[model samples]
Target: MKILVADDSRVMRQIVIRTLRQAGFDDHEIVEAPDGAAAKDSVASENPDLVLSDWNMPNMSGIELLHALRASGNTVPFAFVTSECSDEMIAKAEAGGALFLISKPFTAETFRDRLSDILG
Candidate 1:
């Protein structure tokens, strides 16, 4: 599986990749995007199987990415790996066709648990 990981912070992107490996998803290919606009371009050019994005980002937000993908008739699975987990954000994510909203400060186990159904 090819996974596109989008985040503005380089450190946070590394953490996400490390967590994915620790969660036993090390076999997949990972494509990194510095922000949501780059993420959109990656989606177009890379054809990733899944997208894991930060909710707040420069150029475009995760929710905006999801909406854009949907509007453009792309159905690639999308999810958020973000710090904010407000009910409103969760609702927006769900409504935008996200598969999951994983709060930050997460553990490897959290990724495994939340991803099992979709990635399995």
Candidate 2:
């Protein structure tokens, strides 16, 4: 499985990757995107199995990326791993077809619980 981790902060992306590994998802290929726009491009070129993106990004926002992918008839599974997890953002993410919104400060257990079925 190919997982795309998108975040403006390089450290955060690395952290996410580390968490994925710690969650026992270390065997799969990992892709990194600095922002949502890059993530969109990666989706088209790499055809990742899943996308984990930040909510606020430079070129495009995570929600916008989701909308764009869906509008383009791409059904790749998408999720948000962001710090801005307000009620409104959660609603928007769900309505825009995100599989789930994982707030910041999450643990490996959280990733395992949310992604076991999908990643497996």
Candidate 3:
């Protein structure tokens, strides 16, 4: 599996990939994007299996990124990892084709479960 992680913070990107690795996703090919525009470009070139993105970012927001993906007719799974996990946000994301909305401070167990539930 390949996962494209889009976040403005390099630390957050590292943490997410590290947790994924610790949770037994070492086989995945991980790609990093510092913002939504970069993420979109990465998606165009990387063709990753899934996307894990931050809600807030420079250049473009995660929601905007999702819209762009859909606008391009891409059905690759997307999930948000952010401090904002309000019902409204989740609903909006779901309506826009996000596979899941995961809250911040997640664990390896949460990653394992979320990945299993969404990708299974």
Candidate 4:
């Protein structure tokens, strides 16, 4: 499986990648993007199996990326690994067709658990 880890912070991006490997995704292909716009380009070019993005970004927001993908007819699985995990935010993401979301301050166990439900 291919995973796209998109976040503005280099540290956070590394954390997500590390957590994914620690969570048993070692065989999976991993890609990284600094912002939503780069992620969009990646979707078209990289053809990633999944996308994990941050909520807040410079070029475009994660939600905006989701909406753009939906509008452009891309049905690839996408999730947000965001710091701002609110009911309202989740509702909006769900309404926009997100696969799942994991809140920030998460653990490798959390990544494993949430990812199992999605990848299993």
Candidate 5:
């Protein structure tokens, strides 16, 4: 499976990739995006199986990217890997068709627990 991970911080993206590997997702292809706008473009160009994006990003926010994908009728599984996990954000993510939200400082177990069924 191809997973696109979008985050403004390069370090965070690397950390996420490492954690994904630790979660036993080492076989999958990982595509990285520096911000949501690039992520949106990558969705169209790369056609990833899933998107794991940071909430707050430059150019476009993760939620906006989600909305844009849905508006374009692209139903590729989308989720968030962000630091902000307020009630409002969760509600908005769900309403916008996100599969799940994985907050930052996450563990390998969290990725496994949240992504087993989806990845399978």
Candidate 6:
């Protein structure tokens, strides 16, 4: 599986990738995107199996990326691994066809649990 990890912070992206490996998902191919706009381009060009993106980003937001993908008829699995997790954001994510929204400070176990439901 090819997974795209999108975040403005390089450190956070590394953390997410490390967590994924620690969660026992180390065998899959991983890709990185600095922002949502790059993520959108990667989705089209790379055709990743799944996308894990931060909510707040420069150029384009995660929500915007999801909306754009859906609007353009791209059904690639998308999830948010962001710090912002308001009820409103959650509602919007769900309504926009996101598979899941994982808040920050999450553990490897959390990644495994949430990812199992989607990637399995």
Best by lDDT: 5
State TM-scores per candidate. Answer: 0.97, 0.98, 0.96, 0.96, 0.98, 0.97
TM-score of 6: 0.97
TM-score of 5: 0.98
Provide the lDDT at 91 for model 3.
95
How would you encode candidate 6's per-residue C-alpha lDDT over 1-120 as one tens digit per residue?
Answer: 999999999999999999999998989899999999999999989999999999999999999999999999999999999998999999999999998899999999999999987666
Instruction: List, residue by residue over 3-83, the lDDT tens digit for candidate 3.
Output: 999999999999999999888888878999999999999999999999999999999999999999999999999999998
Q: Lowest-scoring 10 consecutive residues by lDDT in candidate 5?
A: 111-120
Tally clashing residue pairs in candidate 2: 0
Per-residue lDDT over 3-105 for candidate 2, one digit per residue giving the tens place of the 0 to 100 score = 9999999999999999999999999999999988999999999999999999999999999999999999999999999988899999999999999999999
Whole-model lDDT, model 1? 0.94
Error of 2 at 22 (Å): 0.3
Model 5: which residue pairs collide?
A: none
Candidate with more favorable, higher TM-score: 2 or 3: 2
Give one digit per residue, the lDDT tens place, for model 1 in 59-115: 999999999999999999999999999999999999999987999999999999998
Clashes of each: 0, 0, 0, 0, 0, 0
Q: Is candidate 2 or candidate 3 better by lDDT?
A: 2
Residue 63 of model 4, lDDT score: 97
Q: After superposition, how far is residue 66 of candidate 1 from its true place, in Å?
A: 0.8
- The residue pairs found clashing in candidate 3 are none
Instruction: Single out the weakest 10-residue window by summed lDDT for candidate 4.
Output: 111-120
TM-score of 2: 0.98
lDDT of each: 0.94, 0.94, 0.93, 0.92, 0.95, 0.95
